[model samples]
Target chain A: MTDPVVKATALRKCYGDLCAVDGVDFEIGRGECFGLLGPNGAGKTTTVKMLTCALPVTGGDLTVEGLSVKEDPRAIKYLLGVCPQEVNLDPDFSVVKNLVVYSRYYDIPRAEAEKRAAELIARFHLHDKLERPVEDLSGGMKKRLLLARALINRPRLLVLDEPTTGLDPQSRRQIWQEVRDMKKNGLTTLLTTHYIEEAELLCDRLVIMDNGRIIEQGTPRQLIEKHLPGGGNLEDVFLKLTGKHLRDE
Target chain B: MNNSLAGSLSYRAWYMWRRNVDVSLVTWKTNVLPPLLEPVLYILAFGFGLGAYVQQISYAGRAWDYLAFMAPGMVAVGVMFHSVFDTMYGAFVRLRYQKTFDALITTPLSPEDILAGEILSGATKGLFAGAAILLVVTLFGLAQYPSSLLILPLSALAGLLFASFGLYFAALAPYIDNLNLPVFLFINPMFLFSGTFFPLDGLPAWVRLLAELLPLTHLVNITRAATLGLLSPSLGWDLLYLVLLTPAVAWLAIAKMKARLIK
Candidate 1:
């Protein structure tokens, strides 16, 4: 794609002798939702961590908006937002305060942060729970608040690592809808998940990773059609390529 | 990855400090009580009760009331306890249980910023506790004016010193329980033997020499000197020690935390 929002070329991460992400390559165009589908220990989170500048890259090149991850991580962070896999909301902060405090990390001014926080609160349907501490919020509310906080900086690229990993169906659907809306608003997103349906619904193009490498990369339909000529879903393609053995064993 | 020492820190560190202050403000009621009451309780039990029986202790080359002698040391201890405990228990909770540092790393904040902020916040906590105890002592007529005013700023410096010391240990601690080792082994000894409750004059030479090595002893020396309006040229060594030690410890703390946080 011309002027991709994110580009990874032979990206690698190693911990001593154990290489977590073994030279993967992909590109995400602006406003497109890209997915990294994998089982546990598949290096999806490791790749996401590198993209978000949480971990140093061991080898190869990765860039966000033409800024190298190694050379300008701080500058790249200013242009991106990340929703981590874990529920790490500040337990001490109220729903509104959480957004406002996160905004400060981006050097967003107080007045503008408050204004944007108000808008996000209303949009996420958290206006009524503005004063409620994050610990008091339901799991779904917390997830929504995390999404809202990620958008507080008006990021050009949004990274969601298992955004709906443990949500109820209704909450999961709500998050999916919000993500779709973000895409329609032209926000480029890189998402990682093991859920087949979540990937099928959200990703415009995708990659399936296993054992530190991307085994397949294509649109959801193309991947399924290529793997199963006789009509089958993406899950069948995933199982066919990655096998049925439980990764955790 | 900008792993160099200077590149790891930036003005963004203040944001982390601001976040802690926000949390502290929310818990102000509970946070304010310990500093305010600890001195009074100590004075009532030790100063009034114990001092009633003991004769005036000779310190700074003159006879002084036991309460007067002990009061400034309480301020020093307050600085140490507040700064150390906040960075140790409070920062460890944020680092491990809360995963606050993980979230912060995704933002513009480098790991050093988070550690710097914790140290600064801990020092601020130290200042708060020290100032509270100072107020209590002043009300009891224990603090002398002018020179006593210096204690407010000195508390922050002492706070920075102890906070860095605490964060370094926090970074080394494998689990929250491991933090108890420092408290039991180091903090408790410093609290009792840092010339806080009594003069170091009659102690063994080795014990006095060891006390001179503990950061708290110097803090207490300067604080007691200031509170009694007895500042002397000898206190320059104490001031120099704190000044030189704080940044070294703070840099080491930040480096240790960076190694732990950054993979």
Candidate 2:
């Protein structure tokens, strides 16, 4: 097999006395939709941060596109797009300007950036909101804009951290559709979400994590059958594996 | 430059600076007017209002009208305030509230590049404000010597110096309210005691000693001397101090900001 788009061997991240991601191993193939399913503080965000080079990896071997993150992070950044849990949009910019300014960070030329931005704006159904300030857009529109901004670099790996946490059902489905379309176009995606339905619908292969450890890994159907013999959706399997404790505290 | 420093800074910083200009231009009416008007207001209140009572003063080894002496000082003060406010409050908004810094970091830009871009943007604001004051003073016939034009670059350097200081404060500030401490305690006192409104030579020895320790004092000295066509040997030291202090403070700002930004 061609090398997985992402490969992590005993991947780990630690914060002082606390270990966020501990001894997890995974490989994500090209064009496959991989999900890291976990409750809050389950090291999902930390794993994504390490993968995107936003946070340094404390230990273990991790590589994206066959490039070592520790040796040349800039090269790795070029190949990955991240949609953070927070909106983090530049409110000072207009909808189109946000995309354009983001495109510039990758050193895309003005003419090409404009063309690419126009394509993305149209694809994301943001044509009408082009001239509007980012603050004026709804939460869903902000999420869509964030997705488009992530695509500006035309990355090889797309990492989404709770992409639909706050969105309404319609918006969430719309984003799901977008992710499905991107997957059909052969884009590799690594998504982290607590919503088992989102993981079941979007992830081709997934790992259920709790407290920095991956307890199970399989196809959604296999996980549902293996964990819940009665056979239920991912939410049942998720509860079976991760428990229904109140994680908010 | 070592590989680490070289890696930290890049031409990508220009994109960060351009981002600021794009947003500032959208609200130019609110953003541009204050900086342009502030020095003129100072000139009116102090240069004309107070100069009427004060006689011509001998400063920098030459005699000039009080307005002339005060104009350069006002320009320096304008640069200082512009850079500090632009970087401190503006950067805090981007870092904490807007989360723009988080967005930028995801891109190919490094933390150092972001910090450098912020410093450049702050310095550019200072330069524009200083230039506006220079133009207003020149139009009023207060700035006599053509050599005063050198104040433009000097102001830019001072902007970098003050912006680095602002970023240092920003990196350490835990909450937005913590920012008020520096403005009230450090910046305001620096403004009053940095030989801007009056000559430091006339102040007490200890006070003068404290003034010399302030960055604005060196900037003011450079601006006043450069504007009055009074280049002296000590001017080199002033330039050298700002030149050396900028990168040192920037290095500190970058390290602190990295720790705060990168988890």
Candidate 3:
């Protein structure tokens, strides 16, 4: 509908002789939730890492907000917030300190960073744990903190790598609600998840990947119709597309 | 924000250090204090106990109190020893076990900034520990000369050099626990052989060369020169050696961090 905010053209990442992300191409429109759906080791995280410019390209190219990762990773980093698959906050730091101190690294003004950190703390319902260390918080609270920290920069594009991993249903739903709210504010999102429910509920369009390649792609409804016999829920569609083979990795 | 590039870097470093003081104090309590106190105790037991028998040991000109002559050397050793542990083992835990750098990397700060800030933090811890030991030694009257005040800044720079060394090594640590071997093997030997406990006068030529090779030897020599008026080498040469080492070690720290983070 609009100029693509993120463009991936034949993007690839190789570890020694192994090409984890092999020649995958996709484009995400502005203000849309584009998902990378795949089984484990499907190069989803690799793609997210490359897009975040945390990892070297190794091959091909990815452009975020029209800035090529190759040409301008630092600028790309400034414009995006990456919520990694793992919750790696400083466990020793308090709930609020983690977010505020992290924002300072982005060269964000301390007063502004603290203000946004407080707002996000309240927004994520972590107002109570403002002075408590992160390790003391439950798993769900940590996930929420990660989400809050990610948004502190008011990132132009938000990249979530398996955001819902290790989260319970209640926390997952809370996250879903928050993401929907983010969508209302018109923040573009790119995420990868093995959970079809997350993809179905959040993603506007997604690509099903396998063995470093895209097997199927489109909106939830479109993919079901095109790739399956019935345009049912995302689970049935995923089961049909990926088949009965268990993804051990 | 509106300063020249260098001013901004030092400002950012200071800001980060100021904010991290609580954590840094905890680090000093756990890591720097024990190693610092160990050297002070070594000076008291070894220096005072041996000073009576070795009354007129010719250090510079007049016979100095063995403890007084040894106090500044202990200060130098304290900065080196505690700073090595602070930057090596302590930083290793942050780098590998805690992955604290990963937390910092997500921010807008560059690796250079992180490197600079961490080194300063380590140096501050070193200086703090050295200062604490100096106070304890002063109470014991081992810090005899007025020139002993100069030891503080010299120890701070020495601590920084070792801190940079430790931070550089931290990037190479696969596990935080692996640092014990290097500390025990490399640094401990330097402490023993680098004229910390005694003078290097009686040692063979090769042994003296070994002592000369260590950065600790130069630091101890500089501090001892100030305290005991022993001018084996001028203050300018000693400062040159230490000042040259700071940027050299910082460059290595930046290079190692770049390799680790920019993957």
Candidate 4:
């Protein structure tokens, strides 16, 4: 197997008296779609935030591309692209302007930013609404734009937090198809979700998490065979591991 | 980036400022007119309307036109008002309601860069407002000195100072309603007592001492001196006061905002 792109040892995050993430360990290999499966308050978002440098790790050794998150968060940020769980697009800007302005943070030249923005807009099927404000877009369109934006810097690793949550099946499939296409082009993804089907369809290997700890891990098929002996999928395995139904938060 | 002063600043901050500018340009028709006209209205009411009855006034041992005296103070007021609102309300909307800062933090941009960009953008708005007042005063023939051109740079400095104050207060504010405390208690007091509408000489001794401590008082002094071509003994002190206080407040603003934005 290729070297891991991300490695964590005893990862932890504490909020005053509450320990949101506690002593979790995992490794995500290069070019692999690694799923972090958990129920609400399982510290999924906190772990992701730590990885993205949005929050400092309280205690742990977490590294991306051999650079420590604690020591070099700014450098790690350049190698990764993030699609947050919430829709945080600029409401005042148009579809085109939103992408164009975002590219500037990377110091992308004007001509290059324009070209890449157009390409992503076309790829995401935002051609018709290039001039329309972000508030005008449908739920699915905004998610697609978020995906397109995450790819603007041509990052090697993509971090998606509940990427397809609340989307209609059609929109979900559209995103799935895009993820598949990007994976085929050798993209690495770290996805967190409660969706069993999404995890099964996309992730090569995953770890089931509960109470800030990894309970079980392996390929989807391995997890099924190891946990649910008779017959089942990731959802059945999740239930067997956590013993609680996963509900939307 | 390191926590040092130079390390906190980045060229990427210009991009953040550019984002605000781009959005501002889209609403230019609506945004441009208010800053331009509000000062003119203030000029008409205070400079022209009040000046007719007040006639000449003795300011700093010299007799001067009341309109000319008040005009520069209005310019300083516009810069302070615009910068404070931009950093306080405008920054708040992006921070809480819009979640723009959250989106920005995910990128290569650091919290310091975001705060710096905000400071720059707020200052730009203040400069715009100050320039508008300068134009009105010039057309109204209240500006007599070639030194009036210095008002633009002076207002820019005033803009930076007030913007820092706004951002610092925003860091401590919990909700939209909480912002009212600073606006009323801090900003309003500065606006009324900074000699924007009247001479500070006649105010009580304690009041003058209190005004001397406010940042706007120094800014108003420099602005009036620059516009009227009358150099006070305190002009050097005024410039030095603003120059030193600006960076100190700016550093505090950035550190405070970083705490709020970075978690």
Candidate 5:
């Protein structure tokens, strides 16, 4: 698809003998909002970890921004932003310092990094909390700050692992606006989520994976139309995509 | 193209050094102050009360007083212990509870850079504590050997070596219970047996050799040589010992971190 910006072929990840990802092949176009829609334990996070070089690929080949993660993980990481599900901010550092030190880890120039951080903080409506500690912030403020910190490097590809989970409605809407802004700015996103509505609203195209493999792939409208008449709802679509078997995992 | 790991490691070390200084100030109460009180007690207990009874540094080849000879060694020991403790506890907390390394692995920084930066921060903490102890030593007129200035840098190096070892423990520490074993088995034993309080020369030959095998031995020896002005034993060998051990420990730490990161 238009010379994919990210190409993962036969990506296989195993935790010991348990194959978490089994021969999954996928691609994401430049500036495309791609979604990996799945239930829990559906290999979405495992794939994300492999894509971001956070987890070792037992057997596979993957590339991000035309760079091979195997050969150039550091360079690829430089061009990618990851908003993890867990907000692991340094509580000791002030908001500004949190952004500041994080940027330094990427070898981003201090002056430029600080300036960019200030601009992002202002843009994200977090200017007042610049001097505040992380533990003192509201849940929503912390979530937004997490996203801001992720985007501090202005990455080419944004990989979000359940980016919107555990957010209040207002915070979710705020995050949705930021994600939309990222898409409008032509930043490609590879998002993983169990929320069918999030995938429907935000994703341009999607894949529904179960048991470490993509069972179906197409635009959200396409999957809804081809599988369900009238393309009315996603809960029915998800049920049809997956069986009634409860995912205890 | 010269893409040596050191280029990146050094850059990260410098970068992390800057961040840690900022953090050190923010948590100055937690990171810097607790370490401050620790040495004050050690100096008071050993130098004030014990110094009177054991006031003769006969082995130091003069009657300078035990505190005078031990003060520099204590500073070295403080830097070593505190740096190692700071790194292990901070890194273990980050690795286990905070998952900071999990977050950092997603960035452009490699495992080597993370290890280098963390170890550098530990060394910086050591320098801070060592400097504070030096001030106290100066106020009491306890510093006899003028060459002890070199001990500061030597202690910093030794601090890094110990912190590297600490980072290795942290990388492997999978749980809270697993965390305590290393400090108990490895760190405390090194402290007691490193000849921190007593002379190693009088120990059994194998015991002395085991002490020599540890990093603290080289550290305390250098500091003692500096404070007592006893360089006839060769400072170059001491420096060589630290030089050789520093990279090895740092490399092990990096390798362990890299293994852990490839999750």
Candidate 6:
């Protein structure tokens, strides 16, 4: 790949005695969707947090677009559009206001912000809910608005943390369709989720993480073919490698 | 550079401040009502009703009526309440329940930028409330002209000091209820003992010294001087105290918040 959009060399994060993301490495090329697949406590979110500069790196180094996260996090953040795991939309703001106010953080001009907000609103089919408060929107609309807000900055890299974790099938498929469209537009994305189907369908290349380490990394089909040998999907490959015991238990 | 104090801040701080301003605008009626009306109530209860019993008070070495003496104190108190409460309760809600800070960090804003914005917004609220009280006092003919105008800027400075104090407590608070500790223990004492209701000179030597340590005491001193047109060279010390202490506390507040949020 020419000039990877994201590169991590032994990235690590620790909370006192607990090391959440042990040394892990991966790279995502421009226009590629990379997946970090893992169970709860397997450090997928931790690694993502470090990549997004929300959490400090305890050891190792990470660079986005060749700028070190330790050195130029603000610059890296400018290039990132993050949709957090939780719905953090400003409940007091209408859907349009939420997008416009968020655009100010990037120093985007108000007129430009409004124009981009209008475009994203139409794309996400949230034009009808333009004046409605975020709290008033349905679950699916909230998720779609979040995606619209994330795209407002015209970020080079999109970081999604469980974008469709609790959504219904219809909502999840809508999100999947947006991701697919973003991929077609050559927007590089880094996604972390345990849903094997989501990872298999969207990710161009992926890594399976467990106990703060990358246990496997390859194209979804390559991993399935190599791990299963005969006839199984990425889910079977994941279960076989990471074990079926419930992670939270 | 990212971790250093100087490097962590930028013009982006204003955007965070603007975000709060936008929210306040939506609730502008509720936001304006307290500052506009609270002074009138306090003036009736304390300045008129209680002033009748205690007619004259000595301040800045002049015999002044009780209403005139306490009017400036009201402005100081307004500054304290608006700045401290906004940063303490309002900021705590945004930080913990709303996850506003989480959302901000995802963008180009640093933790310092966020805290600076919060403190700035808190100071702006203090200025608004103080100005409102200043208007009320002027209407009562208690505040003198040109000299009293100084209170507007003084309110901003005191606002910064109090806002920093509130933000520090917010960083230390583990739960929303724990914010009450500073209010009851720190702010309540300052409100009563900061020469708002009476002169601190009558108190014991140590008590006066202790009151002097409270930021609001100094704020009251300068504001009282400004409102009464009794500006004195001695008031320079009070101004110095607030000016010196605000930046130190603001730096510490931002550092503490960064330690709490950026881990």
Tens digits of lDDT, candidate 1, A1-249 = 799999999999999999999999999998999999988899999999999999999999999999999999999999988888998999988998999999999999999999999999888899767797788898889889999999999999999989998899999999999999999999999999879989999999999999999999999999988989998999999999999988881
Give the number of the best model, judged by TM-score: 1
| Candidate topping DockQ | 1
CAPRI tier of model 2: medium
Candidate 5 structure quality by residue, lDDT tens digits, B1-263: 11355754646556655665776788888667876778778778987789888877555545567777667767777887778877778878877677787788788766666768889888888887787887787787765456868867776888788888888887788775786898788777777777666667678999888888877777877777776667655768878988998888888887786677666
Which portions of model 4 miss their true places by more than 4 Å? A245-249
The lDDT for every candidate, in the order shown, is 0.92, 0.87, 0.78, 0.87, 0.80, 0.91
| Model 5 CAPRI quality | medium
What value does the TM-score of chain B take for model 5? 0.89
Q: Any runs in candidate 2 off by more than 4 Å, and if so which?
A: B1-3, B61-63
Separately for all candidates shown, the number of backbone clashes (residues 3 or more apart, or on different chains) is 0, 0, 3, 0, 0, 0
Cα lDDT over the full model 4: 0.87
Q: What TM-score do all the candidates reach, one by one?
A: 0.98, 0.97, 0.89, 0.96, 0.93, 0.97
Clashing pairs in 5: none
Candidate 2 chain B, poorest ten consecutive residues by summed lDDT: B1-10
True contacts reproduced, candidate 4: 0.59
Best by lDDT: 1
Off by over 4 Å in 3: A239-249, B1-22, B25-36, B49-56, B144-146, B229-235
Report the lDDT tens digits of candidate 3 across residue range A134-181: 889998998889889888888989888888888899999999999999
Q: In terms of TM-score, how similar is model 4 to the real structure?
A: 0.96
Q: What C-alpha RMSD does candidate 5 show over the true interface residues after superposing them?
A: 3.5
User: Which residue runs does candidate 5 get wrong by more than 4 Å?
Assistant: A230-232, B1-10, B60-64, B201-209
Reference-based lDDT, residue A21, model 3: 93
Clash pairs for candidate 2: none
- Candidate 3 lands at a TM-score of 0.89
User: What digit string (tens of lDDT, one per residue) describes model 1 on residues B25-87?
Assistant: 987788757655776788788898989987599997899989888989889998999999899
